[model samples]
Target: MQSTVNYLWHTDDLLGQGATASVYKARNKKSGELVAVKVFNTASYLRPREVQGREFEVLRKLNHPNIVKLFAVEETGNSRQKVLVMEYCSSGSLLSVLESPEHSFGLPEEEFLVVLRCVAAGMNHLRENGIVHRDIKPGNIMRLVGGEGQSIYKLTDFGAARELDDDEQFVSVYGTEEYLHPDMYERAVLRKPQQKAFGVTVDLWSTGVTLYHAATGSLPFVPFGGPRRNKEIMYRIITEKPAGAIAGTQKRENGPLEWSYTLPITCQLSMGLQSQLVPILANILEVEQAKCWGFDQFFAETSDILQRVVVHVFSLSQVVLHHIYIHVHNTVAIFLEAVYEQTSVAPQHQEYLFEGHCSVLKPNLSAKHIAHTTASSPLILFSIANETPKGLAFRDPALDIPKFVPKVDLQADYNTAKGVLGAGYQALRLARALLAGQELTLRGLHWFLEVLQATCKRTLEVTRVALLFLSSSLGTERLSDMAEVRGTQELRRATELRTQLRALAEVLSRCSHNITEAQMSMGHLSSELAKNRDQVHEDRSIQQIQCCLDKMYVTYKQFRKSRMRPGLGYNEEQIHKLDKVNFSHLAKRLLKVFQEECVQKYQASLVTHGKRMREVHDTRNHLRQVGYSVATCSTKAQEAQENLSKILDQLSHQLLQDRAEGAEASLLPVTPYPIPAPTDLVLHMQELYEEMKLVAFDLQDNNRIIEGLNRVPSAPDV
Candidate 1:
């Protein structure tokens, strides 16, 4: 056990422990900065000094962006407690992330790719230095957290690293048993030192196994069987392959309760990604070491997919990087290989010589002075080459094609193709009409001409005046060659056919030019209609129209995909973006149809409301008239009653006067005044009562109609 009394480095905390070492989260007393001190467990590990020495030497010579840095080493106490101080990685090892049951399936495929690329880069660096990391697993890969959601992965644990001579291999086996290559197992089984030994290929196999474990929570070749598990795993490594295909199948039970929208199915890799990873695993896991890929071959084969990753390298820097384009994808390895071939600089020297700065522009040259430089900013250049030394514009031998080839304009090509399709369709329609003996309309002819003109403009722009002469000349030339063998009858038929073809071609060419302006006008109209439809405000009607449009877009995309074949030469990305045939026209039509439907429904409701409103108005008018008539009749009846009363009272008073002078009135005949009978007045009063009853009945009916109108709800406002 290591004693803490004489320790040079102050071990603040224990980070992790292994069979041979105990890694501590420590503080350097002199520097007063945090660091990771991996103390050797002297009692557990045999030849601890040898392992410690090898690690120290490997770490001392190796300095890479994707490899952990070694700060210092110390040996103290009677136990010879040796400690290797290294840069502290805040985020910890990749194994911790991969092993966490909570997030095992939640880990993203992109994160796996990132980790793989970093390890590959680091391995490539190590291989260039003639060193092999016998052990490569998730446990040895550290993650460095950075600002702005960026991270840097680094290869750690160089305890098993060994520098070898050219094509050298070690007879003794080392590293985690589960990750041991088949060749390592075979050699161990043979128990022979003269046989082919294990080399860098073993490390690659280990890397493959590590990736498999990280991607899926389970090991590809399960290591089981208590004490004999290691032995069984080794035997299986030599004999058995992983079950299922490259990425393996995913079970729902293996994942969290729910997956994030951005992630793919749990533990399942995309085909594009699998295409890159499968080969690496397949080759590295081969029984024959020679068949396995070197770092160069591995990187080149995977660059197309692996290069999709964007890494940010940052430090204390104020300079803003502008217009950086990363054109390098495993090109640095190619450059180094070229340098080793043409120049005296060793591959190891070239590695240190070409340490890259992310921001600065690398100059173009053959092979300039090479020196180490560090990244100054978190810049991921997609179209720039920073890994190559400045002024060394060495083209990668692996990349036969140009790096920055322009993408084909599939959208424009598709549009041009539609014109041809329209013409063919119109021509077919015309032919059918002729066969049916039907008269063609002017509009039909106009459409046929416009479509044909547009098609010809894009596809066949041959000179019209020259076409006739060329056609005749070609026919005549053919006839001259067959003149001696053929009779005049055949010659005449050939000449007629050629003449008809030439005439048709001439007519089409002329018509195309004549209708060019009309086609342009139609195209303009279509564009404007599309624009108007797009700008329409989104209401329920518009939303319904948009749903139709979305369906159309999806159908068009599927149709395009179905039509695409090997030799089509269409850019899939661009062609996918193009709308289907007459999509914009369809969109405009959809908007028009939906809007018209809404308006018609609204108008119908308004018309119905108008009818109801008129009924209410008429009922109101009748009620007012009835009220006026009733008031007028009532006043007339009162006046009649008053007049009758006055007449009766006058008669009574005159009679009294007559009684007082009864003798005077005896001579005069007692003729009564012509006054109407009381029966007549009673009849008039009865007629008035009947008329009031009728008026009341009409008023009550009108009031009921008004109440019904009030109860009906008005239509919703547009």
Candidate 2:
């Protein structure tokens, strides 16, 4: 071997052979510094010229600390082996933990934060540099005992990653099966008889699965009679089912009366562990992916949900119920919003995945009980929208009273008060007071607490709408269909969904009203993003972002476009990014430009068009007056006189003239970007500016009426 730098290593001890390359634990010949060396299979690599060079370019540019550093590559003209030297891990891969029984106590909650932070930091850096780590999995993650809890962790392997921040879009089959997302099926030539996409999101899925295994003692989707034997495990893993009453997920505790299925997990484990894991994986893995949380947002959403409603959904009548409307609405909004963000930020193939599922178009679920969002009490439906601006809206649908004794599944224990069961509740005090002498003091106290609690919960739920509004949202086709129809079915469905959702809007709007003046006073930096998505063009980065999205989608659909695989939108988060949508992005750009330029002074165009219309109307009236005068006098030559009168009226009105009638030859000059009038043309391009404003003012009431009367329809009539 040729002599090189002291840190360089030379070794032939092959650690493992992947489909593309053989990895060797190497060491520097001079410095004795250890490194992992990956040598590509000479025969296979030679056949894929683009992938080979692309990987080289992508890895060469990487410099993040969390990522496994690639030091150098060596190739000789005569030798068939091409090797890449990378950082080596001593404690071994995360896969070691999954395969080991004693790995239960491998990482504590606080300790895991370090690994997560490192991964996030690396991902942030890569995204900043426009590189996506396309393959994230347990095998690729390595942990070392740097702190008390084996805290130190690093992400290895960027072999399947891409740099679509540029104009290029690559469509290739890639990624491992355990973390493979359904949309990935589109681009993937699934080595097995399964469907998958080989996109950046696959890395996130793998990371999520890895994290789940790390956090819990078991795989989220356990093999019921192993996949190698029964195929159910294979199906479950492939299909990406919810944790669905699994060992680590569901538990039954015997209370004084009976036992109930209790929720005892994190928010990431919500909507089935698969959905939770998929989004987390996307955030950690996809470089250009949408931001899910900062430390605060993640824990706020996670802790609040797991502790109260999101996970276990404890205390419907007392705590969770008081905010059940908010919880349900916000849950729907957040889930939908997450989906939108996912679709927007995801790599092409895995955009719509929340769990392992793609965003399958399911019919809208009908809520048996009307969800009352007004702050009165929890769990119980209160404050129905009995009347709407559309004249008393749909008569309150008969709410199927859920058969219950108002018993909530509290996580707390009454024997010693350890579960979510609250002995400190004031409602029970008020109830006892009512049962005895009906003390006004206790009733007043309960009322105050009830209203205060409802108000707070209402605020939280309502703000959720803002977040949902932040996204392009889901089932837009339903909205479109609702807008055009007048049938009973359309009205009924539209009224219900709109009322339920608007009850969502009311929550946000009310919350905004009560937000402390201090918070309202701050110079919100996020206002930059808030500049109406309609006028998002000011963000110069949008086009670049859209370009990357287009490429991702293309890469995701590579297999299918070539008849290799198939898919729809995502099922993970069950939403789509309007920005990621090709037409939507383009339309938004045009709408922004149109608003800023054409519509900014759009009142002028309205004036111009309206003025022209009025002139035509006035001319017809004058011509009619003239024709009436002309009609009276010449009775002997009535036919000729009438013909002449008609000609004169046509000339005066100009309606039957050169502009509207193509056949009429005009002596006037023709200009496409016409200065409609000669004098105005000479003055300058000034008058047409107010057109949009004029149109807006005139149409404002019409718009208000339409919006007031129209409601967004359900996904489908169930």
Q: What's model 2's lDDT at 163?
A: 80
- lDDT at 310, model 2: 24
Off by over 4 Å in 2: 1-12, 76-80, 104-106, 145-150, 165-170, 185-199, 227-718
Residue-level lDDT tens digits of model 2 in 1-718 = 3223333333446565677877777778766888877777756566567767776787788877677788888753345467778888777776765444223322433344455566656665666677767676677777666656545667776677778553333456567654544345323523354342233344445555556556543444434443244333344343443322222211222211111122223211223333433444334322222332333343343433333222211111111111221243343434333433322311121111112122221224322222222222212211111111111011110121111112211111111111111111111221221122111112222332233333333333333333244122222343333234323453445444444444433443443444332123221312321332224224333344344334433422432232222323454112222212432343344334433433333233234323322433343233222222211211212222233233323332342344466743343334343323323322221222132123223333332322222221211111
Question: TM-score for every candidate vs. truth?
Answer: 0.40, 0.35
Q: Rate the local accuracy (lDDT) of all candidates.
A: 0.48, 0.38
lDDT of 2 at 409: 18
Tens digits of per-residue lDDT, candidate 1, 1-718, equal 3334323443456777777787877765555677788888765457655665798899998999899999778765667667787889988888777644223342455677678778878988898888998878878899987687766789998877889744787876777666667666555543435465666667877887787776554455543332133554335434544422232222232321211111123343433354456666666655555566776777676565565432221110111111111235434444445334433344343211112221222334222222222222222221111121111111221121112114334444333333322222222222222211111111122232233333334322322322332343333443343333333454455555445445544543554354354345545544543443343322245445455545554544554454454433347544543544345455445545433644443334334323423433343233333323322332332333334333333433443455577643452233344323334534543554454344334434433332332222332211
- Residue 246's lDDT within candidate 2 is 24
After superposing candidate 1, which stretches have Cα over 4 Å from the reference? 1-12, 48-52, 77-80, 186-196, 223-234, 242-265, 308-718
Provide the global lDDT of candidate 2 against the true structure: 0.38
